[model samples]
Target: MLLDTPVRLGIQIRPQHVSYEDIRRAVLTLEDLGVDILFNWDHFYPLSGDPEGRHFESWTMLAAWAEQTEKVEFGALVNCNSYRNADLQADMARTVDHISAKGGEGRFIFGTGSGWFERDYDEYGYEFGTPGTRLTALAEALPRIEARWEKLVPVPTRKIPVLIGGKGEQKTLRIVARHADIWHSFVTPEELAHKVSVIDEWAAKDGTDVSNLVVSNELQRRTTEDADALYDAGVRLFTLGFDGPDWDFDVVRRWLQWRDGKN
Candidate 1:
């Protein structure tokens, strides 16, 4: 479990039932408000609201955010590994990294996961493989993604930080132990402690030390006391989710105040 990392707050502005202009304004406001990381999700349809309501694609908006914000680190909460080829995903990440970098190493965090939403697959003409199949694909794809990062004409400006989101002990935690710089999940503080121990076991098996791997968890429904418990459990990165039509940031401001106190 991480010990010395600073408290950082991230916001995932779900891109559904809202206009692009509204999202752009929200982005600008979030950066100005000192949000540490800004995230969207990888999905074709609204995760909430009207199922067929208006929604934007993830990567294209992320590209725009790369140019729009200067201070905030940003990426998908978790891009679906099953949506695109591994090499292509790497190239896209490298390109965004270049775009987001302002005379320094870029702020793009390559947060990804094996795809899970079946509707996205069914409508997009991609196979809706079983969880095991998708996890297997993710395990295979990460190496190719890393390889492509090295082979690109203008390689990534920095060793891009990979954030893998999941809590599966058998497959997902093992993958996180092997490849991730950050591991994100929705588990509680107690669960986090147990999961981190499991991840450490996996790290030992992999012959790598993941001591520095940042533990990330959701803060949308949590109180400051709960967040403190998470902090005590070595969770340094806390993310709040904001839904669209009317994106609320009052909670974000409160979390920022909590983070400042912790730091």
Candidate 2:
């Protein structure tokens, strides 16, 4: 509906099954391969059905990645808003922003959401508020985080793009329209089209022009035309996830070809 430009590729490096050396190598290779962003999950332990399967703290690893890599933008896929105080989160993000910039400037995209992990809350002594309440908390935390960043001792090197990940029609998309620079949702082409329509309607009602807003979705298949169709529908940021230090580059290279208008 609001289509205009080409799409790019993002890769999520799971820090659980891989060694730091493995992750560092993966990052360098992705940079060489021309992937756009590198993301990590924000859980202390595995969230994929196993409590002790594998995992790492999102922010700390991001700091490491920030210092270790040069070109790719980096952030959590979606940091749980309820995990840390909004102000502290802002400070941490700002620190990473500076770290990534090193000296020139940093490129950190803030991908965040209302947490949905019950184990994290139960084990860590966090409130683990009801889903509705957690969403409400996430809603409240966002503005506060932005305000605190403004009050930080040294402001972020850049405005720091905010990406809201969720598909809750009543709340998430509304939040995206209100606050997000990019809206990351999971869907097929049909689902994406439906959501895009809803997003536009919400944007117009809220008097928000989302022309510059990026449409992001996970990459799960190998078909080029499916990727092309998504791009045609205004989706520009494509992200893929992998499970190990093995760091598969086949899918990444294929997507990069599409991203760069190669074969």
Candidate 3:
């Protein structure tokens, strides 16, 4: 049996081709629908449809979500580690954590990864290094981020959960095994099972136990049967992406119902 954790549903609100007001309304709607987590990706331009569509920055929107939402944990689905300095990223995460506290502990998940989109780097004047170099930079930055969190005044409301995304067996999975509280990836059930085993091996090598690490996967274009297979493969966190203009929640509702049944 997978981890004995309750099934959790997350929705990634792709901040592309949408207005801020459209996003705001959808956030309230999704929370009311009982999503466990809400996420936005770190990107400068739209990944789908019009490349130059209406896009918003990730962290700024996260800060807004921190203030606007009451219960659902939120962050960038995967913050690009190359975009900002490690110390600054830590401070931003800590501040957002406090902002979302609402008289209780924070509901911020520090989801991050080595960035891949070259356009974002080129247009923004940031270095678009090779994948190896980027992953190495990510490895170097994560510890600095953790250290900065410890040094922050009035530290995070809680030990903010770290969710790392990527499935590279060499660098990414090792990073996840060493530092992640949650691991997000897009893969088939078979691939996920193998990756989970790989993570366990890495964790053992690193002297860390990932038994408590949550396994997350995407839900877009996936069936309930697919979700069941993913669950069988040890995934507990399922996330669906909703893009804008018209952020429909019908698919989300069906998935949430499935989640409720699983829980």
Prediction-by-prediction clash tally: 0, 1, 0
Two-way lDDT contest, 1 vs 2, winner = 1
Minimum summed lDDT over a 10-residue window in model 3 is located at: 243-252
What local lDDT score does residue 64 receive in model 2, on the 0 to 100 scale? 87
The list of candidate 3 runs beyond 4 A from truth reads none
- lDDT tens digits by residue: candidate 1, 1-263: 66798999999999999999989999999999999999999999998769999999999999999999998999999899999999999999999999999899999999999988999999999998799999999999999999999999899999999999999999999999999999999998888878998899999999978988999999877888999998988899999898865777787788889999999
Per-residue alpha-carbon lDDT of candidate 2 for residues 1-263, written as tens digits (9 for 90 to 100): 33464566889887786667787788888888888899988877775645576567789888988888888898999899998999999999999999999777787989999998888888898998787898898889999999988999899999999998999898888888878988998777778878877788888999988878889987776478877777766688888886666667887787787788832
Error of 1 at 197 (Å): 1.1
lDDT of 2: 0.83
TM-score-based ranking: 1, 3, 2
Error of 1 at 151 (Å): 1.0
Error of 3 at 19 (Å): 1.0
Q: What is the TM-score of each predicted model, taking all chains together?
A: 0.98, 0.93, 0.98
- What is candidate 2's CA lDDT for residue 226? 77
